[model samples]
Target: MRVAFALSLLAALLSGCASHSNPSPDGAWINQTAIDAAAEGGNLRQALLAHGPNLEWNIDTKGGKAIASNGFELSEGKIVSAADGKLRIDFYGNSFEDLTLKGDALVQTATDSGPEQRFKAPKEAAPAGAQPGTSFERGLYSAYLGGKWSIVQGEGQGGVVEFQPDGSVSGLPGNDRYALCLAGDCAAMSGEYDSMWLEKNEQGNPWIFVRSGNQLEIFQAVNNAKADEMPDLRPGASQWVLQKN
Candidate 1:
């Protein structure tokens, strides 16, 4: 009897594995291609990453909205399930779509069974990183730092921070001014600041150390890239992800 039960469980697991041919949509998806015949020259030029249960839309990270009505808006979403190469998306106000995974592309079929839209994976998660200890040049980053940097982790994970050339940082409501200190590639905030520098992560992504008295807060830079694309600027939570404009 025990042997029979073990065989049943193994069969169930095998069946589940056989269901989906495409890789799971749990990581970043870049390189898009819209082969929809009815797509009147409407290009699907965006990518998405399913960070566990949360969906990270590229437009939101890049700071923009869809140009057309069919264009995907900058919003957050939850993954109902991803199985058999089919993914169901649910957003606020009952908005959703059923997508299929075909090879390295994500296909979204029209309601009328019209042409389908596809999002392809990029060659790499992000562009290659510069060697560690690369310094931040004030002249190159001055403009990018002047504005606001907000958190992109769905909700309540981060606040906007502004950088001034004089090595001062400010922007969360009611937060006092703080001094910005840089050594090599790492950055820190001290003097009336809520956190201080500790150390960077093993991946060597851009990050900041924040230790307020005894509490610690680490912010990692996401979408880190060279100045040509955009300044490596947005920092979110402990991962310390940053993408600058």
Candidate 2:
């Protein structure tokens, strides 16, 4: 179930909007034209939705921003406009695209008379592991590490810990009392000992650990391209990962 949840989350992040906007990006939107162009009519909408080209628009009082992720290319930019109800966004300050709001979605067009492209909204959330009162099954397991937006399988033992339904864990390093918190996509297990939680590394991917029996895997939940760039740690050096019987 946990694995399925993680996969689903990844799917949503990759193919769909699965967004969280203070203003809700007016719900997720997708530029199907761009998606189709990138896929070259290979019936890859579903795959593209999970591993294709897409963008996210987050607008609020602070400012309007856009995020575009397709394959290994990630573009982030501010939404600029001089006319009412119009948006022009420049990604990485290299190129600019225009968008107009229609009803509840953002519509993109190459020219004033061009066909329209659309972006749709998806789900929202916080990190799974650190959510307060959250629980994992009690058992023994191995561990993995997250990098480049994907989980690195068989990295090592994250911990041989037992998750109790009452919101506590045992057998973690130091045998310390730990509590679960759901702040970002990763949860923080705070207590007597150090906690291993998922957060964005040098790259903007959420790296975290998940347990499944004897396999506690660490993964980069968002971007998996540059995962190999993360530094390696020798066993027993970091309490974040541990072994169990």
Candidate 3:
């Protein structure tokens, strides 16, 4: 039974990692808002490792009515079930409670008193480093941090951040601010800090992310993680992940 349980969990975690019916962009809730938020802390691996599936959508729907259309917006006391899995989460106004905790999906429904949400045991869970200092695994995860990133969020004239393997990150979409880094450590980064990542929901994709702080933002996150996507930027600007080299 113990072995069976472990197998079940593994299956659950790998659910959508492989080939599967992908979620449409419009249908995905972990869109721009999430990416922007995560960028503030800007630790995709750690952020995801500390995952609870933060979502973005309007609830009151009053001024922004579709009124409860997405049924995503919630008041301080509201609870919600996840569309991604079987987990129930309680809200505390600012953020969801019971986050990152191992569990099942939460169910949300209207009741006489108010809406109620419940969490089901999670199927399979995301894998994690057994210890805090697993150099090999951590290095593998951070490899993508190497490269230049443009701000793809702000509509009019947003900002962009470039993460270089040389231990630096920078860009100027519309600001005079700048930063230099030698590692993924957020605390050590120079300049004003504000950025995050938006995980990919579809298959065969690396992930979509953005960095937003103050008045800067990126809309859709994309990449050229594959070799076929790399190429020189200028005569020698270096290849990118998505665009064919």
Candidate 4:
């Protein structure tokens, strides 16, 4: 009886799947018109939407402005050009292509990020003026970086450490507690012990740098690690989270 019941359940599941297996039109495929727009009107968003996937663009029309949207994440973007019938867009740190619009359709081809995905560009509304990384933004970033901070999290056994704008440093990204004593108005780090956290990483070269005003590059970064160790310590990209010191 149990065997019979199992067979019946499998039959029912298969029947249901068969019912929903009908084919439908695939509008997501790229086309020629989208490519034409990228070549003419600089319609990147439209071209990608129409010719590419079902992704909406988070367009910006200002210098150093950031926009957010579902399906795709964008940062470090600026207005390349915008006018009566012209549109151009680009993103910093990431790759994108230049598109031109003409009438209802667009022509888009990959300008960056490899061989590129070329197809028909869709129609999208023009972006408004608002850029990222302004003077006010930089000030806010500096304020966020000011005062003491602890390495709340990172790879390895590296624990928490504090920062003083006085120039001294403590705690490694994933290692010992680095310290730079300060007297009066001066400070400097002595170095890390038993840890390659603070050093230039002569061996593996673990590195850290600011990608933008609000964006910080945090990665494992090992110049040389064994095949097994590599998967565990590769330089995967991640942004830094700000904590009130």
Candidate 5:
């Protein structure tokens, strides 16, 4: 009778262990809530609502690799454990935290004090012909526009200006007045300002032009935009050309 009781206790322990086993986080996850938050925050350059549902996080726990799209850029990083024992992905020197698995969802936080963002695995595969990083590729023009640029041509030929990722500019001529016109009618505004608009050049190169008052400044990439590298910019001699500094 005692031997039978011992055998039963062993079985109970084995069952409990099996029940508490950690779930695998080896798949794709989409975070619609985070995308909605970005849109609500007046991020005009963020992904459109229709495309937001396709942005995803593809994680490979065993391979210690991960790729994520932030509506504007695709970042690939390594899966690592945080100092506080949370799972995180280190992307281009930035740390994305709290990849904790809770039930059928994956929860994350952009920063230590940021709100929890939940992600779920999609029931069906992405629509046909959609690349894994398609959602992020749209923002490559904006991404390549970031950083300091020296005005090599046009009116502000010897001055320096900085273009932020969020579409804000500093160090331009005048009172440094400029508004972000990523979309909509930017040219009608009657102010001496640097307003940006997107278009394609005759050579089929992606061009981002800035309208500073009556003068229109054009910028083209010195090299192709790459997911892993930042590209430089050059403009025509007639307009303003900025070289990345």
Candidate 6:
């Protein structure tokens, strides 16, 4: 009888361990810490500041699906459990990341030796129409319009232009203040300034435009160009590119 009791205790202990081994991470998680760190000039702060104030990861393990959004882009992925118990998310393309459940948070490392970042479940629901993956176009516009930019291929090649947060520009050729064409009727501006707009290329990447007085200057993000070559900046004969500084 004592032997049977000992065996039963061992089984119960093993069952408890198994139960705690794979906790279900089936919900939405946000990296609020990263948002706070961005305000303090932490790593990737530029992109973070350009995007909205938050980053989110949504996991649906039962459906083997996951979504990650950095306000600008929404990436959908497949979630799978690895042999070593790490949760791996394979994004649509070649990108992927692994996560592990800590106490109440999911931890992920940007690289093998990078610091582990924590994502916790939000305490409150996101505001209406303001959830992750919903502000891609607006975030993309903000990213291109904010901060310092360098003219890479336009008539102002090699010159630097600063787009201040107060809608003022320092080094643009013929315009002082600028307004983003977020919606209908960009030409109906009430102020003396240039108007900026964005359009997607064939590859779905964005290209920017600025109507400075009468001459329209087109721009592509320098980072998106091919190595040692410029993209075909069309709609006009001249090529224009902007590199974020």
Best model number under lDDT: 6
lDDT of 6 by residue, 136-238 (tens): 3233323445566788766678888776544456665555655443322332221122235322221133334544322335554233335675432323233
Provide the clashing-pair count of each candidate structure: 16, 40, 34, 35, 0, 0
| Model 1: how far residue 206 lies from native, Å | 28
Candidate 5 stretches with Cα past 4 Å from truth are 1-21, 34-55, 82-86, 110-114, 127-130, 133-245
Q: Which is the leading candidate under TM-score?
A: 6
Write one digit per residue (lDDT tens) for candidate 2, span 110-171: 65434445654322221344321111111100011111112122332332455443324454
Predictions in order: lDDT: 0.38, 0.37, 0.30, 0.34, 0.51, 0.54
List the candidates' TM-scores in order.
0.29, 0.32, 0.19, 0.23, 0.38, 0.40
Residue-level error in angstroms, candidate 5, position 118: 0.6
The local lDDT score (0 to 100) that residue 151 gets in candidate 3 is 42
List ranges where model 3 is wrong by over 4 Å: 1-142, 153-161, 173-245
Per-residue C-alpha lDDT of model 4 across residues 1-245, encoded as one tens digit per residue: 99999999999999877644421111122233333433332223333344433122333344423232212332334546655433455556354444334333333445444333333222321223422212112221223333444343444222444443222344545332221111111111111101113332332333323223322234443334456542223344542332333
Which runs of model 1 end up more than 4 angstroms from their true locations? 1-20, 34-73, 112-115, 127-245
Span of ten consecutive residues with least summed lDDT in model 5: 183-192
lDDT of 4 at 158: 29
Order the numbered candidates by lDDT, best leading: 6, 5, 1, 2, 4, 3
Of 4 and 5, the candidate ranking higher by lDDT: 5
- Compared with the true structure, the alpha-carbon lDDT of candidate 4 equals 0.34
Put down candidate 3 lDDT per residue, 1-245, tens digits, no spaces: 99999999999878855424332211112222222334453544343223322222222212221111111122332435433422233444444432221232223343453333332221222234222112222232234343444443332223345543222334533332222211233312211222232222221211122222222223222332356744211111211222100
Clash pairs detected, candidate 5: none
Q: Candidate 4: where are CA atoms >4 Å away?
A: 1-54, 62-72, 93-96, 112-245
Ten residues in a row with the worst lDDT in model 1? 43-52
TM-score of 1: 0.29
